[model samples]
Target: MSAFDPVLSADTVDQILHLYATRGDDHYGEDVSQREHAEQCAYHARIDGADDALIIAALLHDIGHLLHKFGEDAADRGIDTRHERIGSGWLARCLPPSVSEPIALHVAAKRYLATINPSYLKGLSAASLQSFLLQGGLMDAEEMTAFLAHPAHQAALDLRRYDELGKIVGADMPAFDSYAPMIRALIMKDAR
Candidate 1:
């Protein structure tokens, strides 16, 4: 049961920014860049009163997609190389449970959404939809029941919420600065 650590350093959110800079090559769906998604997730997490660690997790949970080179069609390949698993595994080595758990569980969030919310499933991209089934669509009733019962369930759910709303077309999204406070707070919280 190893814990997760963030690859980004507190001295600078450069890693995230770098990821954003390459959004053109990376982003999977909705035409929203990676940077845009991070900011949006952080913004919504703050508004929803998530704790500092949770906020940072919201901003960075998808980072695994970038770091692992999972590509945009990860869900479509039917390969089980889930970005969440990769990202969560990487984070566990550097970050604390507060940050890593949500990231690790975000994939489960996708499954949960597909199962419980019709509207949620409708919003998924084609690749995301296919990957969803590939990941674990065949879970038996017992497995589904057990998955939702995990401790990180709520965190995964919230992260998913932010992930969905993070997509924006042109403008009207929160600035990156807004996330600074939350990131700082999370770092501090993890340190303490």
Candidate 2:
């Protein structure tokens, strides 16, 4: 398939799974592959008792990185791929706002946390820190205020935390296919 064919064609659960199975091995500068990071994030969300949508949001948050033409080291090259927007935009077509909005806002959530909690920046992984800088570093006062006003801001923050918790080099994680049932159910419900 072409570079973006998978992303452009993936509007259903099966296709989305295929996208991951095909492209998830690229680690995107992190210690874990995209699939591993996604599984770990979902695991963290579930352990924290997040709702279904939030869990799915956590699992798929960085999907845009796979969908883009930019190589995995876009951040290293000082280009912000804006994976949040691309991933969220794609998911919005199949899921409700409950999932997509948080994915969209998660980067902003990171920026917000960095601005409000100095210690938060210290916990970020090297790849995250690089992307964080490319993603506009810290939020200013007005940006923080605006971010706070978004209805899904809290969930976004939660997803951001999970995102950071993922990326363990060799953590045991469930297979990516395990989420297929939940994703299929969500797609079916949203189609109704």
Candidate 3:
């Protein structure tokens, strides 16, 4: 009921999902709702044969945005929101590194992709492209070199790729309840 209720639990996941269901409708310039984007990203991950943890990472990557007090379109206010850090910090407690690491690096993955792949940059949706600007723009050569060497680089890049592809509007996809079991399995015992 509260914004990110300071606790990691099954109920927290439910509250997060409920936030997505209730408040995820505004994607700014995009066609899909925030929840739709999440589900489609997860769907793309499954279709691409990603393992369960990676799939879960794809599904919940933008949760920071949902958890923000400013809501999904917070970037509109010139605030960075830093959803990746916000989401990933809470997530690190609830999930294993396999899931949280890539999430923490996702925006870095975006910046990295933009610098290394011109076509990928060109292919971004207007909203993503705009956020890309607010997201710190393209990585510089030094930053790119460092990012490429990070351990989670590949996984984050994969997450970025699935993220790009997940923007399909009106896509038929599974609901969050379908993912409850896997998410619960992945949650740490202390958290649950």
Q: Pick by TM-score: which candidate is best?
A: 2
Stretches of candidate 3 off by over 4 Å are 1-7, 188-192
Task: List runs of model 1 lying over 4 Å from the truth.
Answer: 1-14, 22-25, 73-80, 177-181
Judging by lDDT against the true structure, name the best candidate. Answer: 2
Superposed Cα deviation of residue 121, candidate 3 (Å): 1.2
| Candidate 2, lDDT over the whole model | 0.87
Q: Report model 2's TM-score to 2 decimal places.
A: 0.92
Give the per-residue lDDT digits (tens) of candidate 2, residues 76-188.
78899899999999888767788899999999999999988989988777887888899999998999999999999999999998998887889999888999888867666
lDDT of all predictions, in order shown? 0.71, 0.87, 0.80
Q: What TM-score does candidate 1 reach?
A: 0.78
- lDDT tens digits, residues 1-192, model 1? 233234444533554555556662466556777667777888888899997777888878877777766566655555666778777776555456778888988878788777777777887876567767777854467767877888877888888888777776664767665666665555555555
What's the ranking of the predictions by TM-score, best on top? 2, 3, 1
In model 2, where is the ten-residue run with the lowest total lDDT? 1-10
**Per-model TM-score versus the true fold:** 0.78, 0.92, 0.87
What does the lDDT read for residue 161 in candidate 3? 85
- In model 1, state the lDDT of residue 52: 77
